[model samples]
Target chain A: MSFSPLIQQLITSLRCLPGVGPKSAQRMAFHLLERDPDGALALAEALQKSVSEIGHCKLCRTLSETEICDICSATDRDSSVLCILESPIDVLAVEQTGGFNGLYFVLSGHLSPIDGIGPEDLGIDKLLERVQSSDIKELILATNPTVEGEATAHYIAAQVKDLGVKVSRIAHGVPVGGELEFVDGGTLAHALAGRRSLL
Target chain B: MSFSPLIQQLITSLRCLPGVGPKSAQRMAFHLLERDPDGALALAEALQKSVSEIGHCKLCRTLSETEICDICSATDRDSSVLCILESPIDVLAVEQTGGFNGLYFVLSGHLSPIDGIGPEDLGIDKLLERVQSSDIKELILATNPTVEGEATAHYIAAQVKDLGVKVSRIAHGVPVGGELEFVDGGTLAHALAGRRSLL
Candidate 1:
């Protein structure tokens, strides 16, 4: 409990990460001190570099080193088909699948009305502008299947439907290769309601 | 795989912690990036501060801010009963029990011949000097229950026995809360050999 000022400082700082409490922070601080001094220095440098260098892409709001992210700049990607996602990590998920050739519009966050977050806060206006300006054929809503995620997707779908751009929401159900027994009630219900013909 | 340079750098640095591999490191880096910029900055500052300010205690070789650690400076602690441990974390473990009021002697490591770590490498010479100079009545070998821990304890016990000091090694067995069926054979053997007469 009576760690040095510096050790205390490090522990206090480490607690800022989600789920890292005081005890974990202390453990992590001691871990860095005992094992890897160079790693600590590297982490420090990386933190500074990340904060100073990485910014939002001008077009999609995805994290990027330059004004435009690699996804936005790639000419090979389908500019006509745009997928709207909630975060940069989601973009990575989609990228990993290698299924869609479309570009993305990262909202950076979803609408949480109780937390004072709304459509304007999530760059929906920019999304509309991009939809109208470009020869975009389809707008795919790929937000998560949470309550707020569904609400955000529906809100966006309503706003963009009249603009003549065909809007579609990503299917929600049990994950690929997942057992039906393990699937939750909400997901099962959604999967049933949104069911399509197998043929 | 295609993280931004800053994000990738952060993830790489975070992997240096014990039990942290590439995936966990990536999660930590992303968590910090998405949630707490201020916390990340704080952790970075603390890393630099802890590395630069904190050093080993002159007497015990344990991590400390001053020349003599708080435990060494305390008048209530029994200097005559020294507990020799393998690392600073061991000292914390002993202190947490609040059962021992004695000072500590940290080896910073154990004797591992296979790893090219021996008596001299683990500060056995320094420990002998401390025992010889002081009015030490008892020298408690409280190292871990590993083979290396036992070897180091035996090596130190041989040296301290010649100095007319009472050398004793802590008992090993199934932990207090551990299930008897799950306890390992080596530990059970050690426990049986060191059995005390129940009154």
Candidate 2:
């Protein structure tokens, strides 16, 4: 009365995706088996190749197939400025903006003592080493605005304080398209506290 | 400024699943790469094995690793009553209800002339052959109540009218737990028309 063994296994395996549940997994398995076998095969091959071949870039800790990512290796990028982020996806988000020609350092995750995540888990030592060794002049802490992210940024800033590099945090305020009425209290407070004097 | 080639390929490939868009695909690719490499590898293996090995059952056309599906091959299931459905997922739905022990015939898709699908494409000839050769006493068309499904059920019923087997379509009415005020007009009408008398 249940699916065949292979079908069942396929459905179970599909549930590893972030938001997929049992029903979605079942639908995905059936969709692959019935409608798009070629796509299913291609996806399988792509997953196998990506998981086995992709690794963290030695320079930035962002996902890369090579030891150094394209941004780190590019001659046109500004190595003197380093932007620190919490995850690899943040690197993509920043790059999509068409601004900020600086180098990047991915922390992989923020500090969370409850989850047992510490400075060493985020490779802060390696980031400090990179900062000390390179000619980086400015460091921008671009981690998320969450409590853990702010703590992580502050910890890294404290570590690099005596390293002679100019350290700064990314601006926190209302988003460009957001209405003031809908903005959260914490964001409004930050925006007011960090307000600049116009010339 | 984009992801590495393999990462990009994996994200693009992940979009092949139903309802997954660019952002979801990217999230899935990164999630598998960062959080669950073992799951990623396992999913790849499962997809490869399922797609390459699973084929339609010889007797029922439902996806199966073996020549015949479990339901069709079981000796306990009734061969004298058949339930015809539009897809393999319907078989799973019916089986989950635990109400009937009749065998199933999967049409893979409903008849759609606009999309160029027809009776031959749904293997109507094979279905007729099975009905004529088997000792089946009755057939229950359990296709969806949509336009195409109704047309398909009607077409199939007409084809098997002269075969001396009793043919019936599953009822169309409001769902058991649905509120009467919220139910659509067509469904409400069907519910009223099909109302039973207990006197």
Displacement of the residue A39 alpha carbon in candidate 2, Å: 0.7
State, as a TM-score between 0 and 1, how close model 1 is to the true structure. Answer: 0.94
Write down the lDDT of every candidate, Cα atoms only: 0.85, 0.94
DockQ of each: 0.64, 0.90
Task: Report the lDDT tens digits of candidate 2 across residue range B23-94.
Answer: 999999989998899999999999999999999999999999999988998999889999999999999999
* Candidate 2 chain B worst ten-residue window by lDDT: B171-180
Error of 1 at B115 (Å): 1.4
TM-score of each: 0.94, 0.98
Q: Per-prediction interface RMSD? A: 1.7, 0.8
Candidate 2 wrongly placed segments (more than 4 Å): none
Tens-place lDDT per residue, model 1, B106-159, is: 996889888898888888898898888888899999998788898889989888
- Candidate 2 retains true contacts at a fraction of 0.94
